[model samples]
Target: MKAVAFVGYKKSGKTTTIEKVARILKEKGYRVVIVKSMHVDFDREGSDTWRFSRVADAVLVHAHDTDALLFRAKDINALFSMVSADIFLLEGFKSIKHVPKVICAREESEVRELNDGLGIAVSGVIASSGIREIEGLPVIDATKEPEKLAEIVEKRGFMLPNIDCGLCGFNCAEMAKLIVRGEKTIKDCVVLSSKPKVTVKIDGQVLPLKDWVQELVEKTIKGMLSAMKGYREGRRIEIIIRD
Candidate 1:
């Protein structure tokens, strides 16, 4: 999947630009997904819902029909796997890697040393009444012309993944949505930097086995022992060994 992100301070029109770009992409016959990120707690503290009862480090919610995800994470990488889209538009992750992005600037004077970083796909500047283009980067006018933003995304490729796994802290669906909005990234998933593997337990003993041979042996023993017991509903069989 391809991904892009929009980054800027509050009232810089990041959210408005994302919506306009998404609409234009959808009209062009491409499968698009959007991911949104928020630091605020969506669930009320005293709510009676099950999800609210046990507070987790983060919470992710998905809507398949709209192909959107709502992600909440303390860290940035919490939504990597949660995004699923041919093209992902993200809204707010500035610390991740390799994402073609648009930096929203209200004016050229507002540009600072922090804008010197690489990986910026485009920079949007708010013009007087209509959108204007930056000489080296694409510019988006948040107030007058939002559709031009979609043209920018189309020139760039799709922006995110679609599996919606919570390994990133956001559900897969939510990640996709935010990616389109320019809000998050896969590198944000610090958890994935470490490899993943299946865990096994034997005779109430946990084995720290990393090799396939050990896993195969343990699985074979378990399967054999399970079949040897003549077990049925409400009935049990015991095995005795003779020396």
Candidate 2:
């Protein structure tokens, strides 16, 4: 499924923009799912529903017709698996990885530095003064033409490739979801080779692994693979090292 997100600071009109976009996409006969992340407590304190969960030890539950419930143990990837939808329009997730994003820009000064690493698909500039276009990116006037914004999302959002190869570990779709949710880190994936490449950081310094360390790491990886075979066969084996 294709995915996109509408992200901005509080009170930046992101919610309104997303609702309008979703309506337009639906009119075009596309199936769309909306995912909203809120830090506020969804369940009331001391309510019957909350009491039942506490008593039953169930972390999450879906009431068939109602929405799904989740406990602290559930993460975004786990949640995505539960819902069925053709396209997911995410709101409030700004840090994960690959989902195209529409950032709400309320000031002209905010336009100078577009954090490319945020993996933004598009940016929506609110009604303001001194707006200028950045090369290779479009700055949108969100208040004037919400439907036109929807068109941009529909055009660029569907162009992404959807191979969930977990080479990115979370898979492509999950990576996009996490990016929109703003909960993903580069260190989470050991297999992503895309560039401008992500650098590994140690302490406060950026450093490359030493040659001896690299060799040791390779040996350790091979050992782990060998150990997996034993687990698959329901047997146990010990690795011994000689000096």
Scored by TM-score, the top model is 2
Any runs in candidate 1 off by more than 4 Å, and if so which?
50-80, 113-116, 119-125, 129-135, 142-148, 157-243
lDDT of 2 by residue, 191-222 (tens): 33342222333322223444455567655755
The alpha-carbon root-mean-square deviation between model 2 and the true structure, to one decimal in Å, is: 10.6
Which runs of model 2 end up more than 4 angstroms from their true locations? 55-73, 109-116, 119-136, 158-243
Error of 1 at 50 (Å): 6.3
| TM-score for each of the candidates | 0.50, 0.55
For residue 105, what is the lDDT in candidate 2? 56
lDDT of 1 by residue, 1-243 (tens): 566777767766677777777777788877777766667675666654336437653444455664333334333333544444667777876644445567766665434422434334344446553544453554556445556656666665443323233556775445544554558655554333334243444322223444564568555656666666563433333333344
Assess each prediction's global lDDT (C-alpha) against the native.
Answer: 0.54, 0.58
Q: Which candidate number would show the highest lDDT if scored against the true structure?
A: 2
